[model samples]
Target chain A: MSTHTEDTKDIWLDECFAAARQDTTAAPDDLITKILADAGTMQQEFATQSLVATPVRAGLFARVSQALGGWPSITGLATASLAGVWIGMSAPAGLEGVTQALVGAEAVIDVVDQYYQAEFELAGDL
Target chain B: MASIEELSDDALLVMYANGDRDAARVLTLRLTPRVFNHALRLLGDRAEAEDVAQEAMLRLWRIAPDWQQDQAKVTTWLYRVVANLCTDRLRKARPVALDAVEEPVDEASGPVEKMQDRIRAQALQRALSDLPERQRQVVVLRNIEGLSNPEIAEIMEISVEAVESLNARGRRRLAASLSDKREELGYVDAH
Candidate 1:
C-alpha cells in the first residue's frame, strides 16, 4: 500500500482501538463477591493442609530445655547433677581435701560429718 | 511498610496461599477488573466474559500455592489463562451475536461524541470478532490492551516475531473491514 493509504489505515484503526481502549468494563460486584467466596473456600483448604502438614510442637520439658540452651546445656546440667549424686553416695576423699582447703580442716570436717549423718538418717527413714 | 495494595501481585499471591484474607481481598480487587475487561474484549459477551473472569481468577487462587515466583509473572500467567479459556469457549460455541456485546457508554462525553465512539467501538468489535483467534488475541493485546511486544509474546507463548507479524496482519484485516464502512462511520468528511 502507498504511504498515504497506510497512514489512513493506521488512523482509522487507531481511532477504533482508541475507542475500544476507553471501554473498560469494571468487574461487577457479584463477580468480586464470587471470587472472594472462592478465595475463602480455597483458604480453608490451605488451612486444612497446613494443619495436617505442620509438625507437632515441642513438649514442655523440651521447650524449657530449648529455652535454656538446648542439648549442650542440658547435658552440662545432667553431668553436674550426677557428680553431686556420686559425691553424696561415696564422699570421695578428694572432696574432703577440697573442703579442708576451702575452710579450715577441723570445723569443716565436723560440720560435714554431722550433715552426712543427718542425710543418712533421713534416707533411712524414707 | 507498603500497604497490601502496594505489594506486588506475586507477593500478594504468596500471602493468599498462606491464608492471608487481606491478601485475597487486595488481589481480588486489584486483578478482577483487569481479568474481566480482557475477557470481555476477547469473548465479546458480558455474561460469558463475567463467567470467564470468575473462572480465571479461581484458577489463579488454586494455583497460588504452587506458583513459582521465579518462573513466571502473575499477570502474565493470568493473561495466558484468560486467553486459553477464551479460546476454548470460542472453539466450542458459535459466533457471539454482536448485539449481545455491550458497547461501553461514557457518561462524561457529549451525546454526539458518545454515539460516534459507540459506533466506532461496535464496528471495531465486529471486525475483531471476525479475525482469526490468534490474530484477534494479538491485536487486542497489542492495540487495545497496550501491552509490550515482549509481554504479549510471553502471555501468548509466541515469539516476538510472531507477535509483530500477527499484529500487522490483524491490523490490516481490521482496516480492510472497517474501510468499507468509513462513510457510515463518519470518516468521509472528518479527515
Candidate 2:
C-alpha cells in the first residue's frame, strides 16, 4: 500500500478503536448483585469449613486444657510458676536460710557440682 | 491496615478466601465491570455478555482459595477466564451474518461529535463480531482493552508472534469492512 493510504487506514482504525474503548456498558446492577452473592456464599462455605476443622486440629490442647479444669486453672498454674521463679531468684528475709536448712548448703553445692561435672564429661565425650 | 481499596487484587482475593467480607465486596465491585465490558466486546450481546461475566466471576470466586500469585496476576487470570467463557458461548451460538446486522438506531440528537463517535463505535462492534473468534479476541484485547501484547498472549494462551499476526489480520479486516463507512463515520479528510 502507498504510505498515504496506510496512514489513512491507520488513522481511521485508531478512531474506531478510540470510539469502542469509550463505548463501555456498565455491568447491570442485577449481575453485580448476583456476583456479590456468589462471593458471600463462597466465603461462608470457607468460614464454615474452617470453623469445623479448627477444633479437630486443636483436640489435644483442648483436651489437656479441659482436664486441667479449663483456662482459669491454667492461668493459676502459670501464675504459680512465675511466683516460684521469683522466690528462687530473691527469697524473703525470713525464708533466706530455708534452702540451707532443708537441703543443706554443702549438699546443694555438691549436687550442683555433680550436675556441672556430668555435663562437662558429656561435652568432652562429644 | 490498608483499606481494601488500596489492596491489590491478589491481596484482596487472598483476604476474600480467608473470610474477609469487605474484600469480597471490593473484588466484586472492582472486577465485575471490567469482566462485563470485555465479554460485551467479544460477544456483542449484552445479555450473553452478562451471563459470561457472571460465570467468569463465579469461577474467580471459586478459584480464589487456590490462586497462585507467583504464577499469574489476578487480572491476567480473569482475562483468560472471560476469553474462554466468551469463546465457549460463541462456539455454541449460531453464526451471525454480518451484513444482516441492522444499523444502530439514529443517535443524532446528541452533540455532533458524540453522535459521530457512537456511530463509529457501533460500526466497529459490528465489524468485530464478524471476525473469526481468535482474531476478534486478539484485536479487542490489544486495541479496545489496551492490554499489552504479552498480556494478550498470556490471556489467549498463544505466543506473542501469534498475537501480533492475529492483530494485524484483524485490523486489516476491520479497515476493509469499515472503508465504505469512513465518510459516514466523520473521517471526511482523515482529520
Candidate 3:
C-alpha cells in the first residue's frame, strides 16, 4: 500500500485533488439534441392520461366489491355484517327490549369476534 | 448579468417552476453532462448511467417549485438524486464485468493517445472498483465532478466536517491502493 500525504489541509488540494475531468471520451453531440427533441414526450403522456382518466359509473358488483378492498371481499363482508345487523334489529317486539340489550352486547362481541376471525379458532375447528 | 439567461440557479429554477420550457432546457443543458459523468463513473455502465442521469433530472424538474434556495442547490440536489439512483441500481446489480470493448472513434489518431486513454480509463476503473462504496462516492464527488466539500456534504446529506473526514479517508485509501502505479497514473514519478 502506498504511504499517503498527511491530512494536510492545503490550498492546492482544494483545486487539484480530483483528476483532470474534462471528458476526453466524448459521445456524439447529437445525443443532447435528440434528448431535447424528446422533451415534450412527458407532457404529452400526461395530457393523454388526463383525457382517459375521467371517473365512470361503477357496476353494482364492482361497487359492492369496492366497498371493502376492491370489490368481492368488500361485498362479502358488507353482506355478512348487514345480515347480522338486520337479524339483530328485526327481532320480535317483546324481545326488542331484551334484544336491544342483547344486541348491544352481541354487537360488541360480534365486532370483536369478527375483527380477528382469521386469527381466532372457529367452533368445529381442531 | 443583464440577460434572462444569466439569472442565478435559483432564478432559473423559479422560471422553470412557472412552466418555462426554455428554463428547463437551460438547466438540463447545464447539468446533464456532468450528471451523466457522475452517474457513469458510479455505475460503470453507460446506458444505466444515462438512465440515472435522466431520472435525477426528472426528479429535479418535478421538485423545482418547492426547492429552497439555501437548503437546496441545483447540482447538490442532483448529486443526491444520482447517488440514490445509483445506490438502488447497485443493490440489484452485482459488480459489472467491463469487457475491453471500446466504442470506435473517428477522431485524429495517435497510438499514444489511444494507449494512454485506454490505460487511464482501465486504471481508473480498477482503482475505483477497489474503493468502498462510500469512499468511492466521496472520491467521485470531490475529485472527478469537482464539487466543493460543503457542496459534497450537502449532496451526501452529511455535515461539512464529515465530508472532510470521508474525503481524507477515501483519498488515503486510494493513494495507498494506487501507490504502485503512481507513475502510470501520473500521480507521482516512480523514480
Write the residue-wise lDDT of candidate 2 on B21-136 in tens digits.
Answer: 89988998899989988888888877888899889999999998888889998989999999998999899998766654433334346687777788898899999998999999
For model 3, the stretches where C-alpha displacement exceeds 4 angstroms are A1-20, A24-126, B98-118, B186-188
Worst 10 residues of 1 chain B by lDDT: B101-110
Q: How do the residues A65-106 of candidate 2 rate in per-residue lDDT, one tens digit apiece?
A: 999999999999999999999988988977858867887867
What tens-digit string does per-residue lDDT give for candidate 1 at A4-54? 233234676687788787766778899999999999999999889988999
User: What level of docking quality does candidate 1 show?
Assistant: acceptable
Ranking by TM-score: 1, 2, 3
Model 2: lDDT of residue A26: 71
Shift in Å, residue A63, candidate 1: 19
Flag regions of model 2 displaced more than 4 Å: A1-9, A58-126, B97-109
Instruction: Write down the worst ten-residue block by lDDT for model 3 chain B.
Output: B98-107
Question: Candidates 1 and 2: which is better by lDDT?
Answer: 1
Error of 3 at B11 (Å): 2.2
User: Between candidates 1 and 3, which one is better according to lDDT?
Assistant: 1
lDDT of 1 by residue, B75-102 (tens): 8899999999999999998977767766
Per-residue C-alpha lDDT of model 3 across residues B1-191, encoded as one tens digit per residue: 36766877788887776656787677667777878777777777777777787777777766665678887777778889899899899889877765632332326566675555545555665666567777778877877676787888888888988878887887777556656765675445333
